[model samples]
Target: MRQAARSYSVQLAIIGSGMAGFAASVFALDRGIKTAQVGNTGAVAYTTGYLDLLGGDQHSLLTDPWRALVELRQHEPRHPLARIGEQEIRTALARFTHAVSEMGIAYTSPGETNLMALSPAGTLKPTCSVPRTMLPGIEAMTQGAPTLIVDFDGLKGFSAAELVANLRDSWPELRAARIAFPDLPPGQVYPEVMARALEVSTNRDRVAELIRPLIGNAGAVGVPAVLGMHNPDRVQQALQQLLGVPLFEIPTIPPAVPGIRLREMFEQCFPERGLTLVPQQKVTRIDLTDAKLRLSLRDSYGEVEILAQAAVLATGRFLSGGLFAGRNGIRETLLDIPVTQPAARSEWYRERYFDRRGHPLNRAGIEVDDHFRPLDAAGRRLDPRLFAAGILLAHQDWTRQRCGAGVAIASAYQAVKGAVEVIGQGSAATRG
Candidate 1:
């Protein structure tokens, strides 16, 4: 039998298909480059639909994100912010987000500002929507006028009564209320079920029926539980039409499917562009020898070795294991890239996981240069062929600025550009 010649050579190999990976693919393709995408979680399935931007009016971000990264490393010391500069960070964000919209995903607004999150509880939290910062968007809401706490009967994880009491104690002027969604199934504690139902539900009439009587005297409707699921715009409009009151949403416990959905939307567009996708695949080991990057991985298709000219690590923090924590504390996985961290993992987080004091668990992650490349322990570029993006870049908190998506978009764009530059002009730059 005659042998068929190899059909294609990869120009890029992206490890994860989350927001960062998807942005990497999009940025490369927009530049007329061929790329491969691989990862599980399917990106879009588990997240809220909106891109988080920096929110709190108080926690004004550093005018320059790159300089801010530098400041972040100084304040915390465990963040990675080597030669990364300001202009490149901004350029990456603009280019990537514009590319995302070009590919059909919407970012709602422009400029490096906050995106409002409509929580499962029909209340709105203007979260600092950027990646890796210290300011809490939830706490920022207290500055708003006479805030109210709202909840659904069967909502789990988010305690309306507890949060309300806390808010009232913190700000006595804050008003609160509890309203039950009649349609929520019994024993359904996760507010997102009702939230999603509210998002795309054709049951505006039914929803109005339940909401009209409850807000008769309240100036605003506060939903501390799932207010709308996938269709916040429609649900909010429907609720407003029925009750004639302003509505807000509050975030509950995570596995935030609404957030996951946002990730999914980004992932779906990659394959159409011919990027390789490998789901449920874990990168078991990585070796950089003779200037070639080798990755050992295991997935449903079984174990395989992937060789490439360049790689982008978007595996995320301890939760995702892209960066691992041990008894001695944080270290980079796979390639052993230099990761920033506190002396101990115990020092990584607050005594209470829920302490809200802001722990290093939320911080101590990765550090990178202007182009988002990993640096070594001595603060030198570890691998010229490798780049880092997303939460792995280190410094700045997403929960603080509500800029997670923005940072992911920005950093991913820059990293892809740097990768393209590294490979230079060559047809067979990457090995499949």
Candidate 2:
């Protein structure tokens, strides 16, 4: 038996639940726009919880992202970050981070210089903003303070010894320790389970007791990012109080706790603020009308529809199913939008795997105009009310450049602003 299709009407419909989609919802909410967002679990959970804003160019790591933006504009004017002014990008990042903080995850304010954030592999990456809980480790690493990095007995992927070995030369005082998580039956430990368990005061106390004995002369302790999922700042602080030392987290491998924390926080908080969120569902079809845009999808209940005055496509690249790679060519999954890509698959990659110049395929994406509107092959706007943002936009390699979150959030802000203007104009015309 087929269930009848359910429907929702809103001023804005955002497709994609990644940083770009979430940022668009935040921007729209600030402007009092009614919004409904739909997307399957995307690459948001793969994030390190670091908001990178133009970390560097291909040649070297950037110290000052603002200065790099100037160089980027001169060299890669077609790049999405170059298309938007620095101030607008700055404002967008600030607003998005601020909202996330307000929603229970505390993040450091974006600064002029990129923070040397710790990665799961013990490498340092230049990032604009970090979770407040992870900030102490950045400072501890910078100062070469005596720090103890602890790993759980059964946790995979994060080796405290490996991190210490890689960083020992740079940070002579760094040390590593392994401890058992409180009350866990272990063959392998999962970060999500440890993070949730730590939310309980007794579990936090038990873990803190184990870490306290291993601290030695270290001034601070670093652990994999398994601090409480909902209130990490509170958990970190509570554990820090018990251990009597500053504590920070190093990012764990993908499907990491910090990324999960952000996803869960937004999912829980967005609805409270009036967003009609359709979490973990992909929009199967879209219909564009002169008056409104209609989106179709399915949930556990069956068919669902979303009608909106404007739509923002934050659908991410290859991994997120926004862009599909065919044997013949790369393609935009939805709307059959023309993608700006290399002529052939052979042209996608350079001869060398680690070529600094990057591959042509990395730059393949849907083309957008000045207002962030998706453009057709003939350079015409596909729809005035349809806008695009995030990694799906053409030009610039996000991975090599290390500007994924910056491009996503900043472009989403611009797209939402454009959508607001279009919707407002439409409303005025109807009243006339």
Taken over the whole model, the C-alpha lDDT of each candidate is 0.59, 0.93
Off by over 4 Å in 1: 1-9, 17-19, 41-84, 94-149, 159-179, 199-202, 217-248, 287-296, 303-307, 340-370, 376-380, 394-407, 428-432
TM-score of 1: 0.71
For residue 386, give model 2's deviation from the true position in Å: 0.2
lDDT of 2 by residue, 271-369 (tens): 999999999999988898647899999999889999899999999999999999999898899898999999988899999988988899999999999
lDDT of 1 by residue, 1-432 (tens): 543322223667787767777778778888876676666664334444455433422245334443445555456554332233456655656666566555543333344434444454334554323211111223345455454555666667666667656555444545555556665666665655566666654655566666666554455555543445433545655766676756654545567644554455455666677666665577777677855577767654455666677788887665566777778767777777766666765577667654544565666666676667788888888888888877766665666544566567667877888898877744354342
Question: Best candidate per TM-score, number?
Answer: 2
Per-residue lDDT of 183 in model 2:
86
Clashes of each: 69, 0
